[model samples]
Structures are given as structure tokens and as C-alpha cells.
Target: MTGTREALDTAPTLDSRRRNIVFVTIVLGMLMAALDQTIVATTLPTIVADLGSAGHMAWLVTAYMLTEAVATVLAGKFGDLFGRKLVFQLSAVIFIAGSVLAGFAQDMLTLIIARGIQGVGGGGLMVTAMALIADVIPLRQRGKYQGAMGAVFGVTTVLGPTLGGLFTDHASWRWCFYVNVPIAVVMIALAAKTIPTVRPASRPVVDYLGIALVALGVAGLILGLEWGGSEYAWGSPMIIGLFAGSVVLLAAFVLVETRVPEPMLPMGLFRNRVFTVCSILSFIVGFTMLGAMTYLPTYLQYVDGVSATESGLRTLPMVLGLLVTSIISGNIVSTTGRYKPFPIAGAAVMALGLYLMSTMGRDTGIWLESLYMLIFGLGIGLSMQVLTIVVQNTVPYAQLGTATSGVTFFRTVGSAFGTAVFGTLYTGKLDPALAAALAGTGIPPEVAQSPAALRALPDEVSAPIVEAYTAAIDSVFRWVVPVALVGFVVAWFLREIPLRDSTRARATELGEGFSMPDSADRVDQLEHAIAQVLRREQRKKTGPPGPSVRVLTGGTVPETLVWAIGAVHLRTRVRGGATLTGIAEDHMVPVGVLEPVYREASQAGFVAIEGDSLRLTDSGAQQAAVFRRVWRVWLDGKLEDWTFDDPADRALLDPALDKIAGDLLDEQSSRPAFAPLTR
Candidate 1:
């Protein structure tokens, strides 16, 4: 009861202007987090120059993504238990601290550690921002705003590399990290003033052990791959120990999930064929996207003699291709509800793109390079946009949170693994090749390795070294071709199923194509899904009249008055009293205007005017209850296209419908448009 009271106390009371401001505040937070995902791509070569460990460079991106992946799962649960507003603010503070630390770092180790901290905060901001949207925005308007957020996500993905390069070339490479500080600081201030407090209805079980096991197991495996031939011998005790330890820990994680009351990832989800196949495809998508983004700039700078800024700009073909196709594919799926062909075609294109990229050499034309990149990105867009939608369409409502997070988790891990493996292959090939080419040339090994220094040498002296860098990078793409082919083969096994109406509606948002981790419970997700449909239908303006519109209120009774009665009953149930002035003020409407509506309701015998408070009479209460049922029925009808195979799903869905009905009734009833009950 106290929990419910706290939620009521902090419930949104924002006017439209203030709500928009809150939306902007959270959007900024989300932008900062997403920006970091690709911002380091162009800066990697420069950072390696200053820090002197090119071999360990992949860890910069890996550390950030790995920690961010773990943090998203933890933050989602924590936000649910504590509150989204508090979590969002704290995440901003942590991000600021991490950014400052990273900017001041003196060595590769220190920079990597700071980046890990940044990842944790960035992950928190992303998940909490999504949750906060459900808190402040009205249900009917949420979909358009969500679509706008997705658009912002797409823009950042294209712009991140260029922005990072701009900071590095004009200011200092450190500015790439320093740039987050002021933006995050402003976000925190705006969040404090504009965002409403939203308390959770119940405490959730935090899977601390499960998260740790997966994090450690994954990190250990990545460490073994990263260090195998570079830091240590392949057969060394340290490498063998790491690989062995990871297997034992991962096996233990499986056992722990089966017994936990609430696991981070439920073992049961793997039993479904679609979930298994989609997870694999998601991994390949991450592998290709991040792996190329991480190393392409290196090849451009080292072999092609391009500036870091130019290198970033040059990557735009790929990003633009990804964006255009993502939006187009999403719309197509929404219209036709058929999704299997996109992944199959996407994987084949991806394999073709990789094969073309592996053919690049010092003499390759710039146009050819861009065309290859565009092909690769197009493949990613087609395959990625529908994975989450299909998963949500197929999974039971009870497992929605875990299932969504699980797919995202796999993608994040794949990104980390991809970066690590690329680094290993590049390093392994580069070292021996560089030594062989530089032998007896009297040029220092370190000087030949540095891009700036190598370019300073005469062509006759630098030609061999350039060839080595070109061949080494080409080897990375060559190795990854098999991985993409595997994804292509797996994509063939994905079975097409009918899209739930809610899922079809949701697929129109391009953000799903980016596959960012979203952490929300089943009810919040359902509300969002329905909100999407509501928005789309609102545009067509063609749905049949609502079931409740005619039957619940006779031709004589104003629909507005029915709404007023429901609000009164809700306030009385939750807060013990409801005054006309209180309801008017909460909605930021004029008290005098709403007074007549209450007076009319009283005259109709639906409410009693007891001093300053309004109380629902027996008839009023029963009428309110019936209208709520009407809304419940209307909502249930929207999901008529979805299947509920398990009894447990219905058990979870039934209560969720009741809560949404109460919400819709209260929110609709309180609007100023409904002030004149007689109308």
C-alpha cells in the first residue's frame, strides 16, 4: 500500500510544456551514451600513438562495451526497484566522473579502466531514459516521441565517428572524452527540474550472481583471445587457464539460472527455435558492424595517408546505407508482416561485402571502398531491424524483459569478441611482416609502426611497411568472412510467423534496427506496443467507434461525465479524497472551468458534493467500474491478433490490462477537453 501511495504521490503532474522539456532532457542523456559507441573509432590510431600499445588498442572499445552490457541489465532492475529519475541522475553523474577520468588518463591501462566506468554509466542512462519516457508522457502521445528518439539514435550512429575525429584533429584527442562532461552536466540539471519522480510498484529480485558470472566468463574468454598470440604464447599456462576458467564459469551460470527465482537470462528461452536463431544472427550483426567500424579508420590512416577527420568522414557511406535501409525495412515489415527474407538476403549481402573489402589494397579506388562499405551496411540494416520484433512477437508476456535483454546481451558480447578477434589477427600478422620488411633498414621498429612517422619516410623506405599494414588489415576481413557466412546459413533456418498487430505497429520505429538494449517489464512494453498502434490508427482516423463510447454511456449521458466519475473514483481509492480543485490543478487546468463538470455530475447523481471533496456514490462507483471494464475490453481487443499459448501468460496479462484501463480512464478524464461534461 505504501508503495502504491508513493507512486501516486510522485505520479506525473506536468503541463505539456514541462513534459516536453523532460523529454528533451532524457533524450540528451541517451545521445551521450550512444555517441560513445562509435566515437573512439577514428581516435584509436592517435590514442595508440600517445600511449604506445597498438596491440592492446581493441580493449579501449571492448572495455566500454563489455561493462556497458552488464550495466544495462543491472540498471534496468535497479531503476525498477529504486526509481527511474534517481537512476537517470546518478547515471549522468557517473558518466561525468568517468569522462573526466578518461580525459586525464596517462596510459593505455588507465584509459581502459576509465572507459569501463564510462560504459557502466552510459548503459544506465540508456535503459533509464527509456523507462522514464513511460513515466512522464501520456500513453496516446508516446509513440511519436519514441519514433523521434529512434531517429536521434540513427543520426548519432552516423555522426559519432566524424564528431570524434573533429575533436581529435582540431582540439585534442582528449576532447573526445572531455566533450561528454558539459553535456552530461546540463542533462543532470534539466532532469532535476523537469522530470517527475516515479516509484516502482514492487521490489524486483536482482540477479547479482548471475550477472557477475556471465560478465566474468565472457571477459575471461575475451582476455584469452586478446592475449593469446600477442601478450603470451598460444599454449601458455595463462591463456589455457583463462579459456578453461571461462568454460567452467559459463557452465555454472547455466546451472544458477535454472534455480534462481529471477534469472538475468532464463534458460527456458533457449528452448524456442526462433530465439536461438535470432540470437545467433544478432551476434553476427554486432560482429560485423563494430569490427569494421573499429579498424577501418586504422587502415585509412596508416596505409591510405588520410587524416583522422577524413577517415571518419570517409566511413559515411556505410553509415548512410545502414540508416536508409533500416528505415525502409522497418516500414516494409509493418506493412506486409513477412520478415524472413530480409535476414536471409542481408546475410548474403554481408558476406559479399566482407569478401569485397578483403580484396582492397593500396591501389584500390576510393569509390570501390565506399561501395563495399555501403553494401556491408545495407546487409546489417536489413537483418537487424526485425530481430527484436520477431522475438517479442513469439515470446510469452512473462519472459518479455529477459528475452529482449538476452538478445541485446548476445549482440553486445559479440561486439566485444569481434573487436578482440580483429585486434589479435591484425597484431599477429603485422608484427612478423613488419620485422621482415624492416630488417637491416636501420629504421627504428617503433618509428615504422607509427602512422605519422612511417609517412615521413621516403616511398622506397616506407613502401614495404605500408604493404604490411595493408595486408594485415586485409587479413582481418578475410578471417571474418567465414563468420558472416555462418550467419547466412543460420538465417535460412529462421521461420516466418505472423506479426502480432502490436509488434507490426512497433516495427515501424527505426530504432529497433539499431538494436540498442532496452530493459523494461512486460507491462511497460505492452503499453508501449499498444501506444504505437494507437498512434498509427490515430493518423488514419478510421477505426470503428470504441465499444465503450455508446454502450457504457447512453445517448443522453456525456462521455466526459463518465470520464469525470472514473477519475473521482480513482482518486478516492488511492488517495482517500478528491476535490474538483485538486484534480483541476493536477492537470494544470482552470479550476473554475472544471467546477461545472463536477456540478453536472452531482446533479446526475453520479457524484456527491461533500464540502470541498467529491465522492462517488454507489451508482457512480458502479458506473466507474463498468466503464473501466469497457476500456479493458477495448484494450484486449487490440491484442486479438496475438496468441497466448500458456495459462501463465494470461495470468500476467489480465492484471496488466486492469492497470492500463485505470490509467487511460484517469488520464483521459482529466484533460481540459473533457472539462465541459454537458458537451
Candidate 2:
């Protein structure tokens, strides 16, 4: 990942206009997908009223959601398998088609199906947008871009309902669908031109079975939640069966992924400590974001009697806070190249904000809402992009795409689950409140309390229903506080590894690039020299392998060439005493090589000859000991294991000793035993 940054730094910079164009293209593409999610919520009433089927109102949202949830995982896999750009563009096309179809839908069923198609596209857009940003931006600069993306999300949240309401009131509600068409077309064109193409270094085989299991598991779980207690009783066999099936399928998916050669989700990525921690942090981020964002506007609209437009407008404070902080944090991360501090601080701030917001009631002031939203936004801005940067920087360049996509997948799953759980809690709270309020007010207890039943009522009947919703939504925020606090705990484990120089020298030293020098080269050269010397010494030792020669020397002189030449001569005469037999055996050579030279020395009256032993004269003994001492010092220094006791060390020492002995013999054989040795 640091390599990516180094590459980017060396690449030519784009002009302001080109950079803006690229940013705007991605932002608009992101907004189209993000805004479509919530825009339909405000327009749902008009659609139901026009189609006269309030019974299927939730399905309008549920279908889009279920398809989207499934799409996120698939898109991530395909983005990695193919290229992110291709999948992203393809998603845009699918979304545009869905938008056009929804705009002209003839019935609620058609519209819901169209929305599902749009969701398939939406999932692709969301995942690919992130992956593409990661591809181009260095880890240092990524936070700023991520922050900018967060701002786009904020803008979409503010605009979605407002635009939906405008379309519902001033024009046909279908225009809400049409609004995406032009934006989608423009984004597609810009993306084709500006988005660089990238392919994985090696293609990993897609796990079709695992993909099926994942999609089925997520779909079943989402369906069971969406329909349980509404379309069917919570205890109904169909709902129970679906939930059970979801668990089984998901378990199978995990098992299958583990054994696959190249699993869509690499299990190894989780082994990285930083990646693991960041993934947990991101999951909590998603949980908190979805859990809180899902309910805040509902509380404003249903409990506080704010119009859809007003609700959207009221969210502006949160949006503004998020936008400002996200951009600021991103820029800071880019400049500093450090990220650990942000997640820690951000999680703490977010937890504080949630804790404060959880204390709100029906009488809570707008100013308080604004304050909580600002604080919450700041916390999100600080942590969100920075965590992404942390995960990217921690992994290898080869695994960058997988690591980034894996975190994204977990976060999205968390968002979906958080939304489901929070929605369940909100509705669970609303049911009893509605039942108590409408018990004696002439409304059927079941009809007054039900989510689907509440939507079916006239505006006059829905007022109390909205009141019930506001209380329920506020109750959901109370639950979000704990989730954010848990996130804070996880953020503390994030490790901070310093980014260092990106040079090849540093990379090689750190075991990242080049292979080190060979260990056997010097050893090989020493071995060959030793073998040649040993062979020559052996030839001289017994005169072509015949019987060993006995040598006699006079008392006045040193005997053999092996004893009186080079290092051997110097060591014997100056430092240590030596016998001819000791020299042959200690040096691992034959005495025949020394015997002839000893006979010559005796003939020259250099050493005393005895029956079993030769006694060196005083001068000869002194010279012999000095020569022996020098030879021993030279041999001991050259032997590899003369200083160590290991087997490998001894093996190295053996070859070195042989070479030393051979060199000494060769030098000695060239001159007289009494010749003075050169320094």
C-alpha cells in the first residue's frame, strides 16, 4: 500500500478542472445511489394512495433494501474478480434502467420490482465507488477523499426527502424516480472517461456456491425480518423456517469459504491484527450510523409533527456537521500520515454524542437536537475515513483490494443488521404506545397498533399513530448509545505502526524486495584451494604413495620443509616447539614428506639424529618452536571453527585447515629448511 502512495507521488498531477470533474462525477454517482434509498420513503404514501394498496407499502422499501443488501456482497466479489470500473459502470446502467422503469410503473407491484432492480445497481455503485477511490488514492490522501464521500452522503440525506416531497406535491410522485435518470447518465459518461482501468495481478476463481449461500442467507434473514409480525406472525412457521434456513445457509457459507482455493473472502486477511481490529471498528461504525440515522428523521416527522420536507431540512445540522468534519479530518490525515489517534478520539466523541442524544424526550428542544447531531457528525468524520486508511496501510499491496473490500463488506452487513434490529425495537415500542392511546378512542386495537395498519389509516386517524412513532423512534436512539460505546472500546486496540521511507534500499533490507547474498560462495573458494594443496602435499609425502621415508637430521638445523618454511617455520622457531611426527599428524599429512627433507638437513649437520627420535640443537629447537608457533597461529586463525564448537563450524574449519597446511608445504618445498621466512 505504501508502494501505491510512492507511485502516486511520482505520477503527474492533474489540473484543478480535471480533478474537480472526477470528484464531482464520483460524488454525484454516490449521491444518486444514497439519495434513492431514502427518497422513496417520503414518496411511499403518495404511491400507495395512487395505487390504492396500502397493504404493500413496506414492500416498496423492503424489496429495494433486500436486493441492495445482497448486491453489496456480490458487487465486492465481482469488483475484485473483474475490475471495479466495469462493475461500477454496469451498476450505473442497471440503476438507470430501474429508475426509468420505476418512473413509468403502472402499479405498486411493478414499481417495487423496479426498485429491486435499482437496488442491484445501488449496491454495485456503493462498493465500487469505494474500491475505485482506494485504487487511485494513496493511504495518506485517502482520508480526505473518504471524508469528501461522507459529505456527499450528508448532502444526499438532506436532499432525498426534500426532493421526494417536492415531486410528490408539485409534480407526479414518479418524478422522484425520474430525478435519478439525468444524474445517472452524466455519471456513467464521466466515469467511462475518467476512471482508470485496473485488473488484479492474478485472477482468483470466484466461489459460485459460496456466493449463492451468502445471497440466500442474507435474503432469507432480511425477508424474515421484513415480514415477521407484519405479513405473518412472528411465530408463524414460514418466518421461523426462513430464519432457521438463513442460519444454516450462512454457516455453510463460512465452511465452504474456508476450503476454497481462492475464496471470495480470504480468511487470511483476518489474521492481520490491524485488519481485524479495523474491521470490528468499521462494523461498529456501520451499526451506529445505521441504527441512529434510521430513526432520527422518523422521530422528527412522526412524533414532532414535522413535514417530510421539514424533517429533511431539520437533518441539515447533522449533515453540516458531518460534511465539515469529514473534509477537515480527511485533509488532516492526508497531511500527517497518521490514523490511530482519529479512531480512538472519534469513537469517544461519538459515544458521548449518543449518550447525550439518548436523553432526549418529547419536550426536547430543536437546539439540543442540533447540538447532538453536530457532535455525532464530528465523531463520525474523525473516525470513518481514518479507519479505512488504517486497514489499507497495514496490509500488503497485493491484498489491498481484498482487505479494503472485506472491511466494507463487514460494515455494510453491520449496517443492515443494525437497521433491522433498531427497526424492530422502534416498532416494538410503537405497538404498545399506539394500543394504549387508541384503546377507547373507537379504533380497533389491532388496527391502531400495527405498522401496516397505521399506514392504512386516513390522515386524521394517523395523527396519534405518528405520535406513537415519534416516541418509538426516540426509544431507538437510546439503544444506539450502547452500540457507539462498544465501538469506542474496540477502537482502543488499534495499533500504530509508523510509515517509513519507500526506497528500494529500505525495502530490500526489510525483506520486501531483493534476495540477500549467498552463504556458500566464500566457503566454496576456500574448499577448492584446500583440495589442490592437499593433493600436491600427498604426492610429495610418500614419493607417489610408496613406503614412508625415514629422515635423519644433525643437531644444528631444522629438518623438514614442512617444519621450516612459511607459517610452519616461523611458528616453530619463534613461538612453539614441534616434532616432525607431530607436524605430519597435526597438519593431517604424511611423514614421508618431512623424512627426506630431514635426511638432507642431517647430511647438512642441521639437526641431531637418534635411533627413534631426532633432538634439535639449541638453535634448531628455538627456530623450530618459533616456526611451529607461527604456523599454529596462522592455522587457528584460518580455520572457521577454531573459535567455536558447532558441527557446521567444524566442517568449515576442516577445509580451511587443509588449505593452510597445503600452502605451508608448497612454500616449504620451494626453499631450503634454514631459509629465513618473509613477513
Query: Which residue pairs does candidate 1 place in steric collision?
Result: none
Per-residue accuracy of model 2 over 1-679 as CA lDDT, tens digit each: 0001111111122334565676777777678877876676556545654664444555565556557766766776576567777898999999999999999998878987998899899877875675565554432233355546655665664467667766776787798889889888999899888766665443445567877888789878867876676568899999999999999999998888789875656677778989999878877876676556655655665555565556666766765666566666655554565667878888888888877777666568999888987898778767676665465456653455456556655666666666666756665676678677786678865454333456567777677766676667667777777777777788888888653212110111110100100011122222222322333344457422111112212333343333443323433433254466754543445677666666665565545556425555565555544444454454444332223335664564454445344434334432332232211
lDDT of candidates 1 onward, in order: 0.84, 0.60
What TM-score would each prediction reach against the true structure? 0.96, 0.60
Q: Report the Cα lDDT for candidate 2.
A: 0.60
Candidate 2's C-alpha runs over 4 A off are 1-28, 41-66, 69-89, 104-112, 126-162, 185-204, 229-236, 331-338, 355-361, 440-466, 499-679
**Residue 30 accuracy (lDDT) in model 1:** 89
Give the CA lDDT, 0 to 100, for residue 519 in model 1.
58
lDDT of 1 at 222: 95
